[model samples]
Target: MKAKIFNSEIPFYELLNNDLSGGEIFTVKSEGLKMTEIEMGDYPEYSEFVDTDAFRDILRAEREKLRYGDSKTVRISSFNINKSKGVLEVGFHPSSYSVYKAFNAIKHYPPQIFYRDAGHGLYEEGTSDWLDTGITGNLIRANHCGTGLFIDCAGPGGVRVIVGMRPNREIIDTHRLFRTYSASGSIDLDDLTPFEGVLREAREEINFEADASQIELVSFGYDSQLGYFQFSFYHRSELSFEEIVTGAKGAKDANEYTSLDPVAFSAENIDRTVRDIAEAPWEPSALWTLVVLVARLILSDGAKKGEKSGVTAARIDDFRNKLEKEIKNRNYESNFKIFN
Candidate 1:
């Protein structure tokens, strides 16, 4: 529901004593003689006053601000639309200049406004590194908590990464894609098995067999919606066109969870697609997965370096013992939430 305040309205303050006791001045409609629902809240006394029409002018100007212009329009796919501040916010592609131009033309509300680039053409690439100087929500908190990404092995040339698509019966064949795919109200960092989960999802969804070593950690990101989070991981091993065709043979009638079309993706197309989808994942948790995949590829290719391996399980019992001793010596527990 929308409440409108018109021009040439007089400002009045009111005090209402009721279940909630708080009051403020309201602008009276010049011709309509109306006020906002908020203005009508529990006020016992109303005081009318005449002052400069600054607030009214500002309101009118804001209302008159146009949404789109003649400039190029770029679509930004976002994991969580709720991530943007205000009741609503407009977002654009990361590489899009028009988005910046449009947003800069209009002053934005503060403390909750930000832009995140998922990547170009509906793939995950650069969302995790996005810095949001706004209040943290559940998705953000989950990303901060501990999620990871995974990339399927493409070829020596690398795989085309796409943002995790929304949960559609057509997209992921839940039964066949993963060895064990399950859902929960919450996931424990200790008990979370994204690697196992994703492998299962890939097998069921795409009918691909992926070895554990074939998966690599990319980066960490979060989804503001669903509050579900994950890590991004990627792989570059590829199959021949024949292999792809053969693997997808019986996908249709098997489970009715997904439909496989053995399509080929070019490097340029894949890059753009991954980047575009990064802005929005069909599932917000998939955003983190996309980010991690992109990050690993970039790092392995000598593009960026010095990334942190924030989560881990000890390889050797001796190392584990030593590390635990050191941690215990310093009396250090993880500063972040680690539910398992």
Candidate 2:
């Protein structure tokens, strides 16, 4: 199989130039839906997190127990984009590990950097199954999963997206963790699929009560460098802006979110907010997932038929251009080199 590439602007396509064959390319689709999985070869150059003394000590203590091949954790790194149904599905299987082991073995590197770098390279070159044989071992490649919801409310003041400010005590504190977010946690070992996991998280994190039918899966993909899968969900709430605020506030104590912020999804505001998010400390998957949803929404019919179509179109374009630039700059700074 030849290398394949898919992104916000491009449609899913298989067989890249017909130059390679027989290699396992995990791009699967069914029933007018598309999914792609890219294997990120060992990324040994990223030392932002591994270089810490604390990380080293943790690694030293837990290295023996966290050996590769000790347990095969299978995760669903799946992204389903259904244009006909107007939904994107990103889902991941949950797994569990000791908190102490995770703290020491896991790196706090920005996930977006790894995803952007690894996804770009994998898209250009076919998948490879090389594991890093460095001091960090293959621990960085452990399969982790999480769910994020992009809540959109369309009312008198146009469309707004709900965002949550993470509390300081949490692992990713202060940074926004999507509207409502949660990791797979101990529930990964259960029979729950990625879709069910997100639904559970939505209820626990934001008191969001919607049948699975009401929510649509947009797109889902895996980031190999980060050794994790991110499942993103799109939910359009019937609640009024005030109701959403009140409901979200009530659930604040149930989750790690410090406060709820509903951001106007105007083009200008999106452009500014995305730029700010790139600069601020943020959950990488949440930020990128939001970017993907914004790109999809701006092109949807709802956005086009809105009262502010002209302004929305112009602002969406601007936001897209700026976001592309941001991704490019960050990729460059990440110094991600693809090794064959």
TM-score of each: 0.31, 0.53
The backbone clash count of each candidate, in order, is 56, 13
Give the number of the best model, judged by TM-score.
2
How well is each residue in 229-251 modelled by candidate 1, as lDDT tens digits?
33334545466434543574564
Question: What does candidate 2 score on TM?
Answer: 0.53
lDDT of 2 by residue, 113-226 (tens): 334234223232223322111111223344355455666675446655545444434643222233333222222445244456566666666676766556654434343333
Q: What is the Å distance of residue 107 in model 2 from its true position? A: 7.0
Q: Identify the runs in model 1 with alpha carbons over 4 angstroms from their true place.
A: 1-192, 220-222, 249-281, 295-340
Model 2 poorest 10 in a row by lDDT: 11-20
Q: What is candidate 1's TM-score against the reference?
A: 0.31
Error of 2 at 103 (Å): 9.2
The true-versus-predicted C-alpha distance at residue 319 of model 1, in Å, is 40
